[model samples]
Target: MVLFQEGLRIKMKDLQNTLEDYEQVKLSCDHTAEYIKVQSNNTEKQIKEDFEKLHQFLRDEEAARISALWKEEGQKSRMMKEKIEQMVREISSLSDSIRVVKEKMGADDVSLLQNYKSTLERAQCALQNPERVSGALINVAKHLGNLKFRVWEKM
Candidate 1:
């Protein structure tokens, strides 16, 4: 009977040890699951931050391009304005010369002859013919050519 008791005690101890081992395995599984969850969240955060940087880069690129476009527009506008102002001055000068000649024509013969050379020179303006301004507009091709490809390449 004592032998039977001894066997029973040993069996009980073995079962307890098994139970403890099972509990340890369960704890390890839970820990592994929590670690995986934490790691996944960290990876997702890193990816989001990377994308935000990309978006910021694109925004900065867009701002720079738009600023350049505006600068080009202002430069071209100023050039055209200067050309137009020059043409207007030339026209005003021509009109003044015509008026002087007409007034001289109304004068008496001796007075007209006295200023004939000066009047003729006034009639012959030294201005050259206005030439067309080449490359006066914004170069759209420089801004827009292969836009997506260029951006991707830059990125």
Candidate 2:
């Protein structure tokens, strides 16, 4: 159980860092959305950069946790179960925020953001079953990558 506990600690630290990145990205998005409302082109580019950074951070964090889970516990631990649940909740909240931001951005950018929002939601739901986390993470990563592409295209 010592290894499991150590793994859990590492996972928890990664999760905390991921959550921090998400929060920072959300804040940047909020600020950029407001700037966009006033038609600030310069701020738009900065916002896109922020989003990309957030995506990279999340991808790295997810990959680390997934690798650790697969190697150490194979997703059988109760701690892993709880961590998944927590991650789901965090992702769900982030998705909701993204949706709101999309709505504010209007119809042109709405589709891509909405797609990302839904993908995150799906990832959140997939956490309940360990077998699904890998697939869900792939989907989420794809969506986030697409989101970065779309945002950059706009800039």
Q: Please tell me which predicted candidate would have the highest TM-score against the true structure.
A: 1
Kindly report which residue stretches of model 2 are placed more than 4 angstroms away from their true locations once superposed: 40-155
What's the CA error at residue 1 for candidate 2, in Å? 1.6
TM-score of each: 0.69, 0.25
Local accuracy of candidate 2 as per-residue lDDT tens digits, 1-155: 99999999999999999999999999999998997877776678889999998788768766765675565554345555776897788777767766765554565656656666654454453333334434223233533457556555645
In model 2, residue pairs whose N, Cα or C atoms come closer than 3 Å (at least 3 residues apart or on different chains), thus clashing, are none
Score each candidate by Cα lDDT: 0.92, 0.67
lDDT at position 118, candidate 2? 59
Residue range 7-105, candidate 1, lDDT tens digits: 999999999999999999999999999999999999999999999999998998888888989999999999999999998998898889899989988
- Candidate 2: C-alpha RMSD to true structure equals 42.2
Alpha carbon lDDT of residue 12, candidate 2? 100
